[model samples]
Target: MRFLAGLFALLAAFFPGAAPAQVVDGAVPGRAAAASVTDPENILVLDLSTGGRVRIWLRPDVAPKMVERVKTLARQRFYDGLAFHRVIDGFMAQGGDPKGDGTGGSPLPDLPAEFNYLPHVRGAVSAARAEAENSANSQFFIVFQPRFALDKKYTVFGRVIDGMQYVDAIERGEPPASPSRILRAYVLADNPPPYVAQPSLPLPAPASTLLPLPTGPAAATPKSAPSPKPVRRAARKATRR
Candidate 1:
């Protein structure tokens, strides 16, 4: 017991980012710790074929249509056992194409453009496309820093709700010498108890965000002042007489 405790302590101390499993199993020193992943969808696990597993929390509200597309592809094993062929340090780590080229796409039909004005902030999950904006299929990339160049251009749908450091730990470049891969990619909120719907009225416009209409209500004007009443003068002349 004392030896095991000492071992655990050493692993936790030296391998600060190493998960407990990695600690015991002799993983890299500065890798990310593993944790149980739970999202509103379902428990989606991302096991790296090279080593270790991670949890992903997908956002459906942000890109409902895209999320549905990804889930559909995952169900059909579109990304099963696929490799993270392209990995760039201090920039982004991309994958999900079966062809293993930065260029391959899914067998399914192409997706329509869902570009929004959202920023390409760090940890942002966005669709990978070709020359066309509406060409996003199954390939995607996770940004590690603000990619302003991608803003207003790419379709940003999700983010790294958890397990980002693990992604950073992966080896870089196509066919990484270490061969990092996502053993599986699954949905989290496949089927949950649906939210109860209650009738609600439209929200009032916020003054700050309200855009002045080209022609709405007329500009308010001050009302005309009523005519001043005539001042009555004292009638003391009769008294004087």
Candidate 2:
């Protein structure tokens, strides 16, 4: 019993060149199928660290700067598996923490604020900030109401297209009593590039970076950072939106 809105239709639109869907209501396909996206309208296909998935619609016309920042961070897996450290019952739940605290953000530097005139309505995506204007990095929350006062002060970027019930179902608190894990967060290119580019980062040379010769003590283990596996960038199929 999930309530859906026009945002769902927007999702269908952003990812273009699609066939007609016999969608009933707005229940999206299962998460795994959702992960294997082929639509270009898809902006953020979240593989939440909690095993739940969410898809967000990016309005290039509305929050262009914000969308660019989000895509870069997502490609880097910046918010992966972080905790939603803050929640206000009846207000909204917040996450995107790397240290599992309200303060922790991405390894990258903070993003200058990009406040637009968008209203803070239900399912609205806006950046969370401290006392300053341009202090946002990787923190945002969805508004469940129209916060008019936040109109020009916060960057109202995107909106929840579907799976809001999942967002609503998350346990709430300044920090939940138990860890509110994100499980794994990742973004699939709504439109994957036609060809796989060689990994831009050069791989370490074979012998030096490879299996130790077993000659000296065990080689130091390198940190294994989880990365997003590249999928074919989806084309903008014909949309029902």
lDDT of 2 by residue, 115-206 (tens): 76567677887776544566666677766555555667667767777667667766665456543444444444544332221211111111
lDDT of each: 0.55, 0.51
Superposed on all Cα atoms, the candidates' RMSDs to the truth, in angstroms, are 26.6, 19.9
Scored by lDDT, model 2 comes in at 0.51
| Worst lDDT 10-window in candidate 2 | 232-241
lDDT at residue 25 of model 2 (Cα atoms): 48
Model 2 stretches with alpha carbons more than 4 Å out: 1-42, 49-51, 190-241
Candidate 1 on 113-148: residue-level lDDT in tens? Answer: 677655777788777665445566777777766666
